[model samples]
Target: MSDVRTKYKDIIEFYKTKNIAVLMGGLSSEREVSIRSGENVYNALVNLGFKVTKMDVDANIARKLIKDNIDVAVIMLHGKYGEDGVIQGVLELLGIPYTGCDVLTSAIGMNKIITKELLKAKGIPVADYVVLDPSNPDKSFNDILSLGLPVVLKPVDEGSSVGVEIIKEEDQLKGKLRNYLRRHPNSFAEKAIIGTEITIGVIGDQKNITILPIMELRPKKEFYDYEAKYTKGMTDFVIPAEISKEQEEKVIEYTKIAFKTLNCRGVVRFDAIISKDDGLPYFLEVNTIPGMTETSDIPAMAKAAGMSFEEVVLKLLEYVKW
Candidate 1:
């Protein structure tokens, strides 16, 4: 076995002939983004001389994988069935080694409410939040009021900020509810942590976790909404966020805590907010399957750590446990 610490291109030679399945595109709100991510993974793997197949996943994903005789699955799916552990569970049953966390970790990571509560119980700082089941949309409005105005309402299980909303005024709450609930019946509201929004990307195995440079997101808009996240120039990324050494250390520490407490595996990104009030980093959410496109934050963070796009892809595949 070669040292996993060796350069990526060299390590990749070991798996050149393995049948790889780049799983992307599914019945999720983020289907298009997943397709792009899968394309990145596909191109990178092919460029590295791997026997790879790009599978635009659908309802019959298992059948497709069976037909392909895939030796490993590089998951690039986002949202619902893709990110919520449904596909991970299927892959587990099929005995297919896939990227990102396992089924249980994927389930906890995708559910915003559960992730927040679990983190809070472990003394990991998280923004105060309330979960409202769609059947009882109005139930948690008052509870959410404790967070005050400018609260963020998001789907409990959705990713890529598909149905995230910022309610600055009381009048905006109803409209947000109507629109958000339509997409995701179960909604969660959290007090907006007013401060610098930083995202930390971590890579390495379960034993040794390596933190990439912290990324500070400066969106042209009020917050890092979906547009700011995907649109090329909508947000400016500050690599190795300009902050005091203490603040950067805090961000890395808390993020690593979330990674371990969540029982995460492979590479994962932890989004956090450094509150302007006390300058404390508050846990936002975990992206188990972080993006792989050129503009994706994880790759940018990896590049800051001196890893190329090909190297990042190879490292992700190398870190796969099952």
Candidate 2:
């Protein structure tokens, strides 16, 4: 923590003269979570003595940014327009630097299908899945059936497991999938990898990245859904996951490859599952703007690595480049 403070001391001092906005509470399914994250970050920046303001993103975000003269944005917005490159493109055009992955990366990272395809191309182990086009229910149902029962249905662009469903039987598949497609036209069906749920946190740029201690999530629910993620006492987090050292090494290696493959920047979280059958890790998806709330995974991993929440926020701020 001391080392990070020393390294970013100049950057911190430079930001003192700038108007930094903690962008949050965007129009997304994860708006409430984003607001919580933004509040924590806003408070940290205030306690650290930086000129910061809280910005709840809306259709008028551009005008608001201009009005406030925000020079930098610590984006705490998650899902939809916030994390799927829309806001990033706006920030890029506005010429205001912000934290986290760039425009293209955010777009790719938001779509599960595209993200998995890219990771698979890079030889990163990812679960087998098929794209579901809302235009064709027949093809979508058949493709999902081919993966066998007990598959996970995921919306391509949603975060926090929003609109995600688990189909265990064939009869339940058609109705649930059709209903899901009605809501989320762009989605995919993945062969559920039943195993230990793990998440890896990475910080810094491609050249100098830090993979924090791996975490294993024991969710009280059937899987780590939205409720399990944000609800208190719903999940037990284990740091330096109970996997073998070799397994840990493989996960970390895959994490590095995925980070660079996706062109991720600042802080990101990679979710994976260690298959109960083979005990090997299969990369799932990446969170470009990971939550900074009290129960967030990134903060827990950083704490395990001996970094305070404030120091992690500073480290994230240090990597802010347009």
Candidate 3:
């Protein structure tokens, strides 16, 4: 197996003289998860003999970045300000190179509805969905029913499945949706594709992309929610998902199309479900800044590809751009 430092020796040497900051712990719902992800990356970079610092992001992040003299930023923040274009825009103004997608890509990828729309237009097979309107709860409820019962509701702009829920019965639909809407006004309901839950990790820039082995996620809970995602043993991960070769090829093709359509760069994760009904993979959503924690799918996928956690960290840093 090739090592990250050995493969990108020049990039590693160049960053040796620079101050790298692992930005995490922002004011997002996924702040705790982000902090964990940041700590792992921070330790990985340190173990790899790189000059790295751990920084908790807040409203004064811009000033903090300047104070620390951060030459490069490895974004470990997951939701809201971190995953959205806000943090990326600030980095742009400060002229600091950062990992992951650019401002526009981050913005689009953060919003599930917009991301779906863009991918759908590019001929990607996304599950049928309807945007929830807070003002008209009844209308939103009706629209959700249109997608049929047993639908999945998710916040339009959240990661780690912060406010995701599944409505199984008609009796529990309206109440669940109303309460969910109250918390996350900007949400959407999508037809649930029952099958093997799978996700694929993609790395590299637009010119050259590498798709990691597809992993099947079997969450012990109702779905891959926050608890299932962060808690150890809450989910079982299967690499090279138990799917036919043809199905795997189609998923890879769709993933590439979605990756290029969103202009995604650095390390990103595309999640989907291979329908048991039709044996077809339905691309769910794109996670631009995938978690780097011990239990994260990205690390697991990288491990299956013969890359260590430290190597994955350095690999992402290699794609840093201003």
Candidate 4:
């Protein structure tokens, strides 16, 4: 993979004569994070000698693209309209090539319940979960008790752990569900896996995907929520995760399978839980358009794998095909 450095020479030459656009700052809940990522990618491309345009995404995005004559779009937006394939669909109609997964894969990967079901169908290990609708708040607590106590209640479509709650006691389940419904309107509950949390960052084509070192997330809070994830020093990231070689190998293998299962391209990240009792890793969810913030997991894993941010960004650009 060291050849990636030399391989980028051709990409650099191609970019020297092409106009690239870094799309960011959508109206999603993650708009602020998107802006940060776009700025980073924009500056990195400029430093690498590519003619770049930093476009804050708006409803008039198509007109903006035509006006700027964007040859390639480097998507830096996260969550909702950005990561959920809406923007990718628009780009497809405009006949523009962009970075990251295609529309179908992006949409599937962004939805937790759908991604879990797909993985489970492939015989991959995933925590047992039940989907819920806020309109019908008449579910029995006994039904949830079937999954056991200490369940995780979260929004089905939200990212950044916006409405996730760790219900430790049975009495608090209904209240938490009500609160989550107030925000999400449609959410679900999953049996919480009491074990180590790990994330795998993958990049490349379908046939040659590379999984970087696994990262372990130890949050000060009970779980890795939005604050613990985005805030500095709230969580400890252990590279190569302190797991057995066999366990590590299993995670890498499953990570690749999960990536392919979703037909993901460019770069993607998967989060999983390693059960302490059995040492088995269970798939949690996949992020098609993973965050690119400096402190994000993908970047951290890439650095551990000896790849610089510039190298990852440049490699991603090369992988983007219409």
Highest-lDDT candidate: 2
- Over 217-322, each residue of candidate 3 has an lDDT whose tens digit, in order, gives 9999978998899999999999978999999999999999999999999999999999999888888888999998888999999999988887788778878874
Best by TM-score: 3
lDDT for each residue of candidate 4 in 1-322, tens digit (9 for 90 to 100): 3465476887887778888999999989888888988888888888777899999888999999999998899999888888999999999999989999999998998889999999988888898887776666667355567788878887777788878888889778867666667677767788889899999988987888888989999999879998898888889999979888999988988887888888989988899999986888999899887888877898889899988888889977878985
TM-score of 3: 0.97
lDDT of 2 by residue, 1-322 (tens): 4566677789777888999999999999999999999999999898788999899999999999999999999999999888999999999999999989899999999988888889999888888898998888889999998988789988888988898888999889866777788898888899999999999999989799899999999999999998998989999999889999999998988899899989899999999999999988999899999999888899999999988888889878878884
lDDT of every predicted structure (CA atoms): 0.83, 0.90, 0.90, 0.86
Q: Provide the TM-score for each candidate, comma-separated.
A: 0.94, 0.96, 0.97, 0.96
lDDT of 1 by residue, 181-285 (tens): 667678788889999989999987668898999999999998888788888998899998987899998777777778889888888898889899988889899
True-structure RMSD for candidate 4: 1.8
Greater TM-score among 2 and 3 belongs to: 3
In candidate 3, the residue pairs with backbone N, CA or C atoms under 3 Å apart (3 or more residues apart, or in different chains) clash, namely: none
At residue 168, candidate 3 shows an lDDT of 86
TM-score-wise, the better of 1 and 4 is: 4
Ten-residue segment with the worst summed lDDT in candidate 3? 1-10
Question: What is candidate 1's local distance difference test score?
Answer: 0.83
Model 3 segments more than 4 A misplaced: 1-4
